[model samples]
Target: SQTIHQWPATLVQPVGSPLSLECTVEGTSNPNLYWYRQAAGRGLQLLFYSVGIGQISSEVPQNLSASRPQDRQFILSSKKLLLSDSGFYLCAWTAENYGYTFGSGTRLTVV
Candidate 1:
């Protein structure tokens, strides 16, 4: 079975601080990885996606960035976090629309 893991589960950061969130998958190979941000009014936004290592695509331009340096590892990073960046961050993987398995998710609260 395949599974995804994300942490630190929840986060509280001040505006203009740095941010880093890690996600990894188990039991799958070469899966397409995606990073999504769920804001209150904005709905779900695709921040980045990677079909393979070193191949990242950004769907929206904001304070978020994503990287896939390993086949099963994905990371979301921000040098300067914003209050608007506060929301739910999710990592998901898909096998051609068969479906996406999301991580536990991170509730980021920025002030």
Candidate 2:
């Protein structure tokens, strides 16, 4: 009975502004969490991932950073946003024999 939750389903951020998105998984233990971004009409791009607490791996060197504060909580942050950062952000967790489960997602638009 595990579920993933992502906050701020949608966001409109200005250029050069700070941004923070949160994701948390419930009813699971030591799950693999990941952050992905998808541009309009494009395939998803992996941003970051964590196999365990305090262990994060960045897929691309962009204007984004991720952290796993608690065992089931993950955070994505940016000091200064860019126009290219606008996309659909997704938080997912790998389940045992259930594949990957995703959150409701957050659509960020940078103007």
Candidate 3:
């Protein structure tokens, strides 16, 4: 069975700190990876997507970045955190003919 894992489930950071979140998928090969953010009441926003290793597409220009180190691992990082960067971060993967499988998200709060 394929599964996606994302962590740490929650975080609270001071302003200007660094941030790193990780996600990995198992039981699948070469899946399309994605990062999304959901605010308190807003809709889900697509932050990044990767079709293959080292191929990342970012949809927004917020203070965040993503990387794909291997076929099944995706990482999200930030050099410095901002107060507005607080939100729920989600990692998901999908392949042809299959719906997206999402991991447990990370809720980040910067103060």
Which number leads on lDDT?
A: 2
lDDT of each: 0.91, 0.96, 0.94
Which candidate do you rate higher for lDDT, 1 or 2?
2
Model 3, 1-111: lDDT tens digits are: 888999999999999999999999999899999999999888899999999999999998989999999999999999999999999999999856778889999999999
Candidate 2 clashes between residue pairs 3 or more apart in a chain or in different chains = none
Scored by lDDT, model 1 comes in at 0.91
* Superior candidate under lDDT, 1 versus 3: 3
Tens-place lDDT per residue, model 2, 1-111, is: 888999999999999999999999999999999999999999989999999999999998999999999999999999999999999999999989869999999999999
Model 3 clash pairs?
none
Report RMSD (Å) for each prediction in the order shown.
1.4, 0.8, 0.9
Ranking by lDDT: 2, 3, 1
TM-score of 3: 0.96
Show where candidate 3 strays beyond 4 Å: none
User: In model 1, what is the error at residue 55, expressed in angstroms?
Assistant: 0.5
**Candidate that beats the other on TM-score, 1 or 3, i.e. the better one:** 3
TM-score of each: 0.93, 0.97, 0.96
